[model samples]
Target: MIAIVDCNSFYVSCERLFKPHLNGKPVGVMSNNDGCVIALSNELKALGVKMGTPAHYLKEQVARGEITLFSSNYELYGDISTRVQAVLEEFSAGIDPYSIDECWVNFDGFAPGQLEDHARELRRQVKQYTGIPVSIGVAPTRTLAKVANRASKKIEGFGGVCVLYPDSPQTKGLLQRFELGDVWGVGRRLAEKLGNMGINTAWDLRNQNAKEIRRRFSVTLERTVLELQETPAIEMIGMDFARERIMTSRSFGRLTNDKGEIREAIRQHAQRSAEKLRKQGSLCRAVLVFLRTNPHRQDLAQHNPSMIIELNNPTDDSREIVAAAIQVLERLHAPNKRYMNGGVMLMDICERGTEQLSLLGTQQSDAERQRSEKLMGVMDELNQKMGRGTVRIGTPSAGAAWHLRCAHRSPRYTTRWEEIPPVRL
Candidate 1:
């Protein structure tokens, strides 16, 4: 059987972890630049504060004490997520951390009664450790477990854990009630198409001939539906220990006709990407730089250019990544054009130990790599403990013209003292 463990109101719940007074209040977390709502509490949802609703539109709600808004506190949320995952790991033999607030666990070889008890224990442990509530759903298939999870949300007596065994009456009822769109892999477009064919419910889709579904739809859809009909075909492997590519991108607060500001933005992006590479104990063999004018603004002259630079050797050294990034920047930059966004993407990444040295040119000396690694380690440690960007490259300074305009951003209350949120008694 597969079990899905999902956190309730994750971002808002993270805030409530330390501030228990917000238990029954309407609260939400804003997206980047404090532009819109990304996470909302149950109270906030009931008040019609829809997800992705711009904060500006909710000003009246804020004034009326109808909603409390918070900036995205990634540090606090990440730490809490780690704690919750740790608690879950203690019980389940295998776990797939699907997202920040959701995970899938393998529960095979366990009896039906044992599965129910284990699910309840998982909820209790996670709540006790992280002060956040979670819901667990168990079924023969991952898709059916997801349906059981939805049903659990409606039944308060379930205590946040629901099991949908294959032969159970509740499981059959759930399949009949759930819409096709509500299934795991079906999106709006596919759901509408399926509904046209009268495949409105989960059971209906499951009962359809697998080969007919493949020929009518696509191979991917057919496979997904087939998996949902029985036990989950996918298996959870061990954790992802290897690092991948590192990237840094952002839209500027204002359109920049000046080339100097564009260069500054690219430099800052390169520096940020380099920092991320070092954090993951990885190095880059290629760097990609790109810039674009605001496509939405028809008034501005259009210019979109991107260039990739291959390195002579893979290196975690910030200087090397910065140099390669600048090479691409020079190639992509256009004259007499206003650029609205610029970014650096570090690719062809590999672990520090596995990186291949330049065959022709003398490789970066051991002392040089060691010095850079030490500096990056110190910077990472400081940032991890004190908060991100507390000590960062001066290129992204407050006075930079390319800085994002985040006037409505809430203070980093848990990370920085000066920017801490003010609490009212």
Candidate 2:
């Protein structure tokens, strides 16, 4: 059987893990740049603070003590997620971490009754270890397990675990109540098509002929529905090996008309992206740099220019990537234009060992590559031990007009010593 485990109010739970006083209080976590509300606690939801509502729009409510808001604290959340995943790893033979707060576990053994007990135990262990509550859904298929999980949230005494066995009467009732859109693979467009055909419920779609569904839709969609009707066909497994891509970007803290500042911003982004490339054991063959003016201010002159540069060789070396990024930045920069934001994107990534040699020119010597690797290694280690920007390129500081305005950001309570949040007795 496949079991889907999802953490409840994940961000709020993470905050409460360190600050217990927030327990049962209205809380919400903001999105990147603290622009909008992303995660809301039960209390916050009850207070009518909807998700995605901009922080600026909620100023009045916040002033009235209707809700507590927090900037996105990824460092704290990432640490807590790791703890939660570690607890999950102990229960199942294999686990597929779906996202920050969700995972799918393969429970190959144990009967129906045993599965229930296993689910309860998993929840208790995770909560005990991480102080985070989770809901578990067990079924023959992943889709049914998801539905069972959502249903479990409303029921009491389930201990956050719900199992839907195909042979049980509850399974049929659950299928009847589930909407097509609620199913895993059914998207809005497919759901609308199904609604038009009167296949509005999971039971309705399940009862349809697989051959007919295949003829109406594609083979893939038909297979998904058939799997949902019986048992989940997808296995809980690790992600497939594929090339990675890194896009690093940031907006200037203030708009500037200086060409030097624009170049500096792009160079900083490129350096950051190259650092990430080295960390991931990959090299880039191409880099893209772009600059843009503020889109919201329609009355202002807007100029968005971008350029892509091909590298002489595939390299994870920050120096090479930064050089190529600056070349593109030079071409895209406009004189006397106030640029609001700029970024660098590294692409055509390949493993360092598997990099193809140049056909027209001599390949880099082993000693040269080794020296470059060693330098990058030391740079990364120093940056991690200290803070980011501690060992940055000189160009990043040349025209430092573009910086983040994180005036109200909470300290890196878990990751950095100087930024740790203080606890009160």
Candidate 3:
């Protein structure tokens, strides 16, 4: 059997972990720059606060103090996510971390009759250890596990865990009740196409000829249909085989046309991206830098420019990546233009050892490679032991002008020592 465990209202739950007073209240989390709503608690959903609503539109709620808002605190979230994953490691041997708040567990050795009991215990232990509520779904295929997860919340008597078997009679009604658009792989366009064919549910899609569906749509859709019928063709791949792309960007607290400020932002982004590359043991051959003026400000002259630079040899060194970003920014940067945001992207990634050395003499020597690797490893270890930014590239000096404006951000309760919660006697 395959099982998927997903955290419930993850961002809101994260905030509630630090502030217990916010529980059972209408709470929402905003995106970068506090622009739009990205997460909504059940209470907020009940209050009709829709996801993606502009922050300015919620001024009335803010004034009334009916809704609690938080700026995205990624440092706290990432740390808590790591803790949650560690707790999950005790459950099953075959674990695939699907996302920050979700994972798949394969129950190869466990008895089938005790699966539900095991899932219930799993949920109890996670909440006991991490203070995060999770819902689990168990089924024969990964797709059905997702379905069972959704049903766990909506169906009565599930108690945070739902199991569905391919041969069970209940599976048919549940599949028919679920909308086609809600299926795992079906998108709006595909939903509309399927709707025209009078196939509007999982059961409808399952009844269609798999070969015909493949001919009409593609093999991917055919696989979805087969998966619905309880055939396990979709298996999780290992991390080594996974493709990855890392991008770090943020909107400024205030728009500035200063070249130095823009340079500082891109440099910070490059340094952070390089850190992630080294953690994954990957190297990138291309770096992309983008700069843009705020489109909402009508009085300002809008300029959005981006540039991509390809390196002769792939590297995970922060210095080389920052240099490449600055070179591109020099070409893309404009004078007297108020830039609202800028970012750096590391692309064309490959495993560090898998990268073939160029025969044309662009590759570094063995000694140089060893020194670079040692320097990066030490830097990463220091940052991990201390807090982030404890040791960073030298481009960002004291009191940098490009800091983010997080007026309502919560404390880094999990990551920082100074911000840890106080216990009352």
Candidate 4:
């Protein structure tokens, strides 16, 4: 059997971890710049505020303290997610992370009859160890596990764990009742297309001929069709494969024409991208930088420019990557453009040992490569041990325009010593 364990209202649950008093209260977490709601608690959902609703739209409710809103606290969320994954690792035969808040758990040696009990125990232990509530779904296929997991979460009688067998009557009823869009890979548009063909439920899609589905739509959809019929066809290739390109970008706290601030943002992004590249044991041959004005506002003059700069050698060194990024920025930077966003992309990445060396042997010196590796390794280790940005490429300018506007952010209760919660005796 396969199982998937998913955290419940993950972001809101993380916030509530520190402030238990907020339990059962309406709460939402916003996106970067606190622009719109991205995570919602059940209480918040009951209050009719939806995902992506503008944060300003809830100003009156916030003013009256009816609902609490928080800026996206990635540091806290990431730490909690790691802790949860660790707990899962201790129990299951094997665990594969589906996302920060979800993982696929394999039950290889366990008895089928005890799967639900075992899954419940897994849920209990995760809560006991991490103080985070999780829901588990067990089924023959990963897709059905996802469906059962959603049912366990959204249904009340299941008590956080639901198990379904391919031939079970309960499974049949579920597939019949579930909307086609709720199937693992079906989206709104695809569901609409399937709906027109009378494939309006999970059962209907499962009944379709897989080859016909492939001919009509795509191989991926055909895989989903087979998966719905309890065949495991979807392979998480993207999750298993190393990324071909790495990108880091974000909207600024406020728009600015200051070249220094734009440089600062791109510099940070390059440093971050380089960190990822090294972590994956890959090197990039080029760095791409782009600057853009806010596309939503029409009153302001607009400019979006991008440039890619090649490095002397394919490398994962932060210094070289940041230098290449800055070169691109310098060439693309247009004065008085009031750029609201900037980004860095590491392109043409390959495994460290597989990079094509220049034929002339006229590349970064051997000693320089060794030193870069040592320095970057030390920097990564220090930052990992002492928190990110402890040993960064450069000091960020105070009041930099690229800084995020997270005015209502909660403390980094788990990751930062200074932000850890206080106890009253």
Report the C-alpha lDDT of model 1 over 1-425, residue by residue, as the tens digit.
Answer: 88888899898888887678889999998886577899999898898879999988998978888778887777667767877888887777877888898888878678877989888887888888778998988888777888778777777878788998777877767778888888888899999999998889888887898889999988777866776677455554434554577779988877777777777788878877887787667888899998989898898789998888898878877677877888888878888888888898999999888877655544456667678778878877887787676666554556565877655444445567786667789
Clashes of 1: 0
State each model's C-alpha RMSD to the native: 3.6, 2.9, 2.3, 1.5
- TM-score for all predictions? 0.84, 0.89, 0.93, 0.97
Model 4 ranges with Cα > 4 A deviation: 238-240, 362-364
Ten-residue segment with the worst summed lDDT in candidate 4? 233-242
lDDT for each residue of candidate 2 in 1-425, tens digit (9 for 90 to 100): 88888999998888777778889889888876667899999988887888898889888877898777887777778778878888888878778888888888888877767889888888999989878999999888887888888877867756588998777788788789888888888899999998999999888888888889999898767777777776555654454344467899987877888877776777778888988787778888999888889999787888998888898778888888888888887787778678888888888999878988867653556668789989988998998777666787763553367866444455666678787777679
lDDT of 4 at 331: 89
What are the per-residue Cα lDDT tens digits for candidate 4 across 148-261?
998998889999999997688898888898998788888999999888888789998889899998998999898887887888887654345689999999999999999999
Question: Which residue runs of candidate 2 sit more than 4 Å off their true CA positions?
Answer: 235-240, 252-254, 258-264, 275-280, 359-364, 378-401, 405-407, 422-425
Report the lDDT of model 2 for residue 95: 83
In model 3, pairs of residues that clash are none
Q: Sort by lDDT, best first.
A: 4, 3, 2, 1
Tell me model 2's lDDT, rounded to 2 decimals.
Answer: 0.81
Q: Show model 1 residue runs off by greater than 4 Å.
A: 108-110, 236-246, 253-268, 275-283, 330-339, 349-357, 361-395, 399-425
The whole-model C-alpha lDDT of candidate 4 against the native structure comes to 0.91
Residue pairs in steric clash, candidate 4?
A: none
Residue 38 CA displacement from its true place in model 2, Å? 1.2
**What is the overall TM-score of model 3 with all chains considered together?**
0.93
Better of 2 and 4 by lDDT: 4
